[model samples]
Target: MIKTIAAWIGSYADHPDPRSALAGKIALVVASNQPFYPLYLHWIVGTAAWPAWLSLLSTPFFLAVPALARRHSFAGRALLPLAGVGNTVFCVKLFGAASGVELFLLPCALLGTVLFRPDERLKSAIVAALPFIAYLFVDAHLGEPVMMTSDYARLVALNGMSVAALIALIGLLCSTQLATREVEIVTTEIPGARQHVDISD
Candidate 1:
């Protein structure tokens, strides 16, 4: 089954197929949200409303899929989610950890693993680490960790689910374009624009 899907996804090369790119981005969004599912459960049982910030980290990944599907900016698909991860790390300090804060590292690592090529992986590792590293510095400066207390069941469930999701994500990513080919991104101009003319002539 794995081999079949792997062949279907295609061999990696200097560039990604548009379909494979779309699948990769969608997979990212799916993998990114695994942490949030349990967090949402915590909110539902613990609060009257879902906190908007809980959705913060994965939103860009979700939003970027259409553009990626359309074969838009490679940087947008590849880099924007890193910003979201960084934002989430900072958010953990400002908010509380019960939103499955630590679990984000799983997705961040998984994201880097799939989105980056062999040559790019080192830089991708650094970029992926920067936010958490920055947060550590900020956290040390600020003081100790902030804990958000949740029910024992919720905590256990969140942790368990996070681990399972991480494993599944790793498995899924093994079939992605990164595993099959090198990538070369093509930049395309927007469909419409004003062209200059010598109207005075």
Candidate 2:
């Protein structure tokens, strides 16, 4: 099942540049995993409400990421972080400041850093900046939560765990991509260098 999902993500990562292709794959992975969040919140955590159900409305936008990547890698990369910002903001509004959903902005910012090519510094900066802007906006404007919870600590704890899990997942994927690129670079620059790589570690 994991191999199947990885292959599906790879199909959309056909950009000419390795970095861009990896960016698209990262977007695709995030897109594919999004639909499960509401489920986890509603069923597993039991902290979701009707407003939380509305969060699913954003799933289609995320699902469109691969198609966008197919047409324009940069657009797809841009969309993922932008959409994540919107989604996180909306969720924070739904659950309020105490729910800790706003913590997701960290990963959204991290995505923007790796999704764009090094030469596209301006675009990456703009994308990355949106989260901070949204964070401030959310902090200042959040008046009342759409869904109120009796146990603020539980919601905060749950969201903290969720955010931590997401960060770890994204970090692992980004690190794996970096490792693969290093190997590719070494082999390409020096023929037969691939044989020196140890696989039994």
Q: Which regions of candidate 1 fall more than 4 Å away from where they truly are?
A: 1-23, 27-39, 42-45, 48-61, 65-74, 80-84, 122-125, 131-135, 139-153, 176-201
RMSD of 1: 13.7
RMSD of each: 13.7, 3.2
State residue 20's C-alpha deviation in candidate 2, in Å.
4.0
Question: Which residue runs of candidate 2 sit more than 4 Å off their true CA positions?
Answer: 1-10, 13-16, 43-48, 194-201
Q: Give all candidates' CA lDDT scores.
A: 0.50, 0.75
Give each model a TM-score: 0.54, 0.82
Worst 10 residues of 1 by lDDT: 184-193
lDDT (tens digit, per residue) of candidate 2 on 1-201: 999977766775657655556556656666666667667556644654667777877776676776787787788778878888898888887888777788889988988787777789886788989999999865659678788766677767877887787778777877887898897898789966777665432
Global lDDT of model 1 = 0.50
Cα lDDT, model 1, residue 194? 18
